[model samples]
Structures are given as structure tokens and as C-alpha cells.
Target: MDVVRSKDGTRIAYERRGSGPVVILVGGGLDDGSENEPLAAELARHFTTYNYARRGRGESGDTAPYALQREIEDIDALIGEAGRSSRLFGASSGGALALEAAASGLAVDSVAVYEVPYMADDAMVRHWAEYVDQLTVLLADGRHADAVELFMRLAGSSEEDVSGARSSSFWPGLEVLAPTLAYDAACLGDGQPPVGRLARITQPVLVATGGGPDPHLEGLRPSFFDEAADTIAAALPNAERRTIDGETHVADPQSFAAVLEHFFTSSGDFRQVSL
Candidate 1:
């Protein structure tokens, strides 16, 4: 892994694979760059892939008091290190970060994202406060396990699914990263999509979601999944929507990469999509 210094002088760690135009993969909550290696490898043939650890996870250094702009600068630092304005693909909460980066006017070539967890109404937002409150208390008290469960609920995980995950040995890693959950909450901007800001994104963008008919999810309507994706796509000035039938939150990299390749390879323009 290589390191780049953020504007704040924090060391951001990243690994580059293959060769061609640079493409950076941003991982979602509780994940570092390692989780996106599958997708990075799939994209490597067509583009050089940079899989980097987000701040507070893996090898990246986290400065005191995480702020939204600091995270954006992390992406900017990677873009500078990549030696060009690169295409970025962020999954889940990381998608929210990528959108903010593009909207921040980082010299991005294109942006692609998967299921950014946008609320279609204020109902989710109302609960977001309580969720964050409880999560903050849990983390402050060092109850990492309970904090993880609260976060799972906020992410719409059912009790059964939460129990199952807790039983798994990998659950502790999530517990370790519990504090960073608040960072994702902050990036989401009060628990809804930032319509006005997203509208300012001038680069060609693709917003994608799982098109599963019955994927056995809990806490929200199944239809809401596609609705959230559509909401984000509608907000972006130059964005297209794509659905991968039968794919859910944990998407198959090979299948997801095809959609990404198609979107990124096409000669899409802000004027073409926005107008």
C-alpha cells in the first residue's frame, strides 16, 4: 500500500492494481479497501484500480474530530496521488462521500455508486436522530456490541439477521470500527439525500441499486430500495439509473462491474443527461 498526505497532513493508504485510466473504489461502512478488492480486480483490466482504506479504518490515519470536508480531502488526496482526475465508485455510505466529493468540485472524471441509503421521506429522518443519539451513547460508553446492533437496526437489519451476524466470528471487526459509524451518519447529512447539492454535480454519474423482487429484507418496504436509488438519480443533474436484477446490498462484483464498465465506457456528458 502507498500513502498520500491529505490537506490536514494525515496519511491516507491506498493500493494500485493493473494499468489504464485510474478508477478508485471506496468501501462502505465497517469496511476498508480490502473488501473492494474483488471489484477492483474486475475493473483492473479496463482501468487502473485504486483501493484505499477510508480514514479511521485499516491503514489510514484518522485525525481528531472527523469532519465531512476532511473525508472529501481524503478523496482529493487520492485523486492527486493517482496523477489525474479519476473515476470513483463508492458503495453504500461511501457513495454518499463520493457524491460529496464530486459536488465539492473535485476534478472527477465520472462517478458511479451503489445503493446510497437515501430516505424517500421524512419518516426515516425522524428516526435518524434517535438512532444517532443511541449510537453515540453506546460508543461513548464503550458498548461496541450494542452500538453495532443499533447501527444494524439503523441500516434496516432485522433482529434475526442481527443475531446471525453477531454469532459470526467476523462481527468483532465491526465492533472495533463502531465509532466510525458516526462518521457515516454525518456524511449522510441529517439522514436524507442532499438534493440541492447533488443537483450541482456536473460530471457524468450513474446511480444504481439492487433490482431484487424478494430479497428478504426487513424494517423497510422492499419497494423502497429501488425508490431510494431512483431518488438519488433524479437529484443528480447528469445522472442515469441502472438496476441489476436479483442483486442486493452485497452485490456480486463481476455482475456489478459490468454495469460500471458500461456506464463509464459510454461517452456520457453532463449536458446530454441533465437536459
Candidate 2:
């Protein structure tokens, strides 16, 4: 893994592959470079892929008093390391971070975000914070299973689906990453203010939703994925929105790769196309 030092001197880790224009894949939650290796490999055929571990994971350094800006700096350092002017693909919370970085003027050439859970409204944000707190307490009490349950519940997953995931091997790993849930929540804010700050992001942007997946909670208002995509598209000068039909919050790589290929290879003036 190649290493770059963030502004705070934290050593960030990333894997560079493929050989055309550079594209960085930033995963959400506890994901490191390895989790996205397959997607990176697929994209490698067309672009130089830089798959990186966010701070506090893999080869990266972790300092106390974590601030959201530090995360942005981490991406900034990686973009610089990749020689600037690279395309970016960020999923979940990573999507939110990527959008913020682009808006902050980090020189992203093109960008695509899949289901960034921005609480584009106030009620959603409050409920999200409550869920974060509930999950935190569950984790503290050694209730990893319950923590996952709470998370899926907050995310609007059905009871049966949550129960099924509990038996899956991925559940344990998610538990380990549960502590960082608050970080994602914090970045999203209380859903009141629109992600207006991101309006300045000029990079050709694609805001996407997984049409296959339902809202995490039952009776939850409008879909978070739609909310996020619309919020971003409305803000950016050059932006489009797409929904990956038959794909949910947890999507197959092939479907995602197809959507990505279209966005990255688009010609003309950044037309909004739904795949």
C-alpha cells in the first residue's frame, strides 16, 4: 500500500492499480482498501484505481480528537498523491465525504456517489442521531447482535432481513465498525439544512440511488437515497441523478460497475442519464 501523510501527519494507505485516468474508490464505514478490491480491479481495466483505507483502519494512522475536516484532508492528501484531477467514486458515508471534498475544491475530475445518507430534512436527522445513540449503547453493553439489529432498524431494514443478516459472517465485522456510526451521523448533520455547501462542486457529478433497496425504516418518509441524490443534483452546477434498478443499499458489484462505466465515460456536456 502506498502511503501519504495527511495534514495532521497521519499516514494514509492506498492501493494504486489499472492504467488510464486515475479513479479513487472510497468505501464507507469500516471498509478498507481490501473490501473494494474487486470493484477496483474491474475499474482498473479503464482507469488507474486508487483504493484507500480511511483513517483508523489498515495502514492509516489515528489521532485523538477526530474532526470531520481531518477526513477531508485525508482525501485531499490521497488526491494529491494520485497527481490531482482524478475521478472519484465514494459509497455511503464515503460518498458524503467525497462530495464535501469536491465542493471544497480538491480538483476532482468527475464524481459518482451511491446512496449517501444525507438527512436533507430536519426530522430525519434527529431520528438518525437517536439511532446512533441507541446503537452506541448496545455496543457498549456487549450486545453486538442487538447493535446490528438497532442499526438495521434505524436504517429502515425489515425485521426478517435484520435477523437474516445477524446470522451472516458480515454482521460481526459490522459490529466492529459500529463505533464509527456516529461519525457518519455527525457528518450528515440533523437533516435540517440542505447540503447547500456542496452547490459549488463543479466536477461532473452523478448522484445515484439503489432502487432495489427499500428505506431502512418502515414508514420512514421519502427515501434517503433519493433525498441525497436530489440534494446534490440540485446544488451542483454540473450534476445528474440515476437509480440502479433492482439494486438495494447492498448492491452487487457488477451493477454498480455498469453504472460507473457510463458516468465516467460520458461525453458531451455531462448529461443526466439513468441506468
Candidate 3:
């Protein structure tokens, strides 16, 4: 692992592999770079891939008074180490951060995101606010395990799944990184698609979603993800929407890598090619 110091002097750890054009993998909540390593390795076949632990997770360091800009700076630090420019692929809320980085005027060549976890309804907006409030209280009260459970359920974990996780050996490690859940919440401001903010992004973007049933949650509509991806794609000036069939909310790494390889390696034009 190599380390880069963010603007705040916090050490950020990353793993690099393969060669060609650079592509940085940004993972979502509960991810500490390990979750993205498989995808990175696959993409490494044709491109240089860097998978880094977001601040407060894995080998990365954290500073006091966390802010979303701090996380952006962390990505900036990684970009610097990557020779000051790179394409990005983000999963779930990490997709939100990647767009924020690109919109913030970072040197991003292109972007691809999978299931960025956004809602467009008033009820869901209230639900998201409640989640943020309860999560804050739980973390403040030192109920890290409960916070993790809450987060999992928010991500569509069933009762049985939550119980199984609680009994698993990994539960303790999850608790240790529970506070960073708030960082992800901050990344997903208002839990709705930020069309105004997203419109500023001029980089070519691939907004993708899965077309299969959510394996973890029964009765969940496939449109849940498609609509989110569509909303985001429409907001961006240079973007395309894609739906990968027979994949879940978290896509199979190989399938996703194939789509990304096509998009990232495209010849400047955001359209006309199949993915």
C-alpha cells in the first residue's frame, strides 16, 4: 500500500495495479477499498487502477470536524499521486462523491457510477432526514453496532440478514468504522438526486443500474435503481444511461468491469458506442 497525505495532512492508503490510462475506484459505505479490489483487479487488465480506502476506513487517517470538502481533498490527493488526472468509477454513495469531485473542477477525464442510491420523493426525503438524525444520536450515544444495523437496513438488509451479520465475527470491525457512515450520509445530501449540482459536470459520465431483482430484498422494484440512474443521466450535460441485465444493486464485478472498460476507453465522444 502507498500513502498520500491529503490537504489536511491525513494519510490516505491506496493500492495500485496494472498499466495504461488511470482509473480510480471509489467505494461506498462499509467499503475500505477491499470491496472494490476485485473490480480494480479486473479493470487492471486494460487500465491502471487505484483503489483507496476512504478516510476513517481501512488504513486511511481521519481529522477532527469532518466535512465533505475534506473527503474531496482526499480524492484530490490521490489524483495528485496519479499524475494529476484520472477517470473515476464509483459504487453507491461513492458515486455521489466522484461527481462532486468532478463538479468541483478536479482533473477528471470521465466518470462511471453504479446505483448511486438517490430518491426523488417527499416521503423518502423525510425518511432520509430521519435516518440522519437517528444516526447522529446513535453515534453520539456510542451505539456503533446499532448504527451499523441501521445503515444496513437502510441499504435494504432484511431482519434475517441483520441478525446474521450481528452474530458474525465481522460485526466488531463494522462497529469500529460505524462513525464514517455519517460521512457517506453527508455525501448524499438530502437523499435526492441533486440535479442542479449535477448539471455543472461536463465530463463524460456513464450512469448505470442493474435490471435484476435485488437478491437481498424481496419485492423491491427494478425501477428503483433505473430511475435514479436516469435522473442523474438527464442532469448531466455529457452523460449516458445504461442498464445491465440480471445484476443486483451491487453488480457482479466482471460485468461492471466490462461496461466500464467500454465507457472509459471510448474515443472522446459520449455516445454512438455500445456498452
Candidate 4:
């Protein structure tokens, strides 16, 4: 893992691989950078990929009294190492971090984001604050497994699904990474989409949703993911949106990479459906 020091002097660990234009892959909630290795390999054939552990997880060192700007600085540090004007591809909440960075006036050339679930409603807002509070306390108390379980439940994992995950061998490993869940929540901002801030990003943005239409719903209506993709696309001045068929919120990396490649290597113009 290569080391880059954030402005606060936190040691951010990342793997640098392949060659060409630089691209940073940021993973979502409760994950270390390893999960991005596959995506990195696929994109590595084209771009030099910097797959980094967002601080507080994996090999990255964390500073105390976490703040959201620190995470942006971490990304900024990586961008500095990668020529200071490279594309970024972030998944889930990591996408939120990348967006926040671009909005904060970072030198990001472009950003391709998958499933940044910004909580944009009153009902979601009411419960979201409480969820963050509970998650923070759980991590503070070292209840890693409980924290992971809570996150899964909040993400709509069924009881059977949660139970099956616990019985699996991977559950324990995931529990070890569970403390970073709060970091993801914080990355999403203080429980709202920075609509104003996001609009300030003049760089080209690709906001996309995953998953095909529900087989039960007969593909007749838009899903929540589609709504989110549309809302973000509408808010951004230079943004395009798409929904990748058959890839859900968890995301399928190869499909996502294809979209990123197209967006990154284009003529700085994109098309999107008008709402």
C-alpha cells in the first residue's frame, strides 16, 4: 500500500496499480479498500487506478474527533499524488464523499458516482439523525457486530438475510470493519443532500443508479434508486444520469467501470433525460 499524508497528517493507505490517466476508486460504507481491488484491476487495464482505504478502515490511520472535511482532505491528498486533476469513481456513500470533494472546489477533472443515496425527505430526515446517533454510540462502545447488523437492517436487509450473513464465515471479517460505518454516515453529510453545494461543482458529473426493474413490479415504475439518480442529476448543472440494468445498490463494478470510462474519455458533454 502506498502512503499519502492528509493535511491533518493522517496516514491514508492506498494501492496504486496499472497505467494511463489516473483514477481513484472509493468504496462505500463499512468497507476497506480491498473490495475495490476487482474494480481497480478492471480499470487498471486502462487508467492508473488508486484504490485507497478511506481512513479509519484497513491500513489507513485515523485522527481523533472526526470531521467530514478531513475525509475530503484525504481524497485531496490522493489527488495530489495522482497529478491533482484525475477522475474519481465512488460507490454508495463513497460517491457522496467524492461529490462533496468536487463541490468543495477540489481539482477533480470529473466524477462518476454510483448510488449516492442522499436522504431528501422529511420522513427520512427524522429517523436518519437518530440512526447516526445510535451508530456512533455503537462504534464508540466497540459493538462492531451490532453496528454492522444495525446498518444492514437500516439498509433494508431482511431478517433472514441478516441471519444468513451472521452464519457465514465472512460475517466476522465484516464485523471487524464495522466501526467505519459511522464514517460513511458522516460522508453523506449532516443528513441531507448538499443540493446547493453539488450544483456548485462545474466539473462533469455522472450520477447513476444500479439494478434493473423489479420483476414483481413488471418494470412499470421507477425505483428509489432511480429517483435518487434523477434528483442529483437535476440539481447539477453539468451532470448526466443513467440506471445500469441488473445492478442494484450494491453495484456491479464492471458495468460501472464501463460507464466511468465513457464519461471520463469523452468530449466533456453528456446527455440526460429531462424530468
Among these predictions, the greatest lDDT belongs to: 3
Model 4 stretches astray by more than 4 angstroms: 213-222, 273-275
| lDDT scores of the candidates, listed in order | 0.85, 0.76, 0.88, 0.82
Displacement of the residue 136 alpha carbon in candidate 4, Å: 2.5
Residue 149 local lDDT, model 1 = 87
Q: Could you tell me the lDDT of residue 266 within candidate 4? A: 87
TM-score of 4: 0.92
Backbone clash count for every predicted candidate, in the order shown: 0, 7, 0, 2
Candidate 3 TM-score, true structure as reference: 0.96
In the range 1-275, model 3's lDDT, one tens digit per residue, is 99999999999999999999999999999889888999999999999999999999999999989999999999899889989589999999999999998889899999999989888667767878999999999999999999999988877788888999999999999999899999999999989998998999988999988777886755344566677787898899999788787888778889889889988988565552223
lDDT of 1 by residue, 138-185 (tens): 888999999888888777788888999999998988888888888888
* Candidate 1 runs further than 4 Å off: 213-216, 268-275
Residue lDDT tens for model 4, 8-55: 999999999999999998899878887788889888989999999999
Clashing pairs in 1: none
Lowest lDDT 10-mer window, candidate 4?
A: 213-222
RMSD of 4: 3.1
Q: Rank the candidates by lDDT, best first.
A: 3, 1, 4, 2
Root mean square deviation (Cα) for candidate 3: 1.6
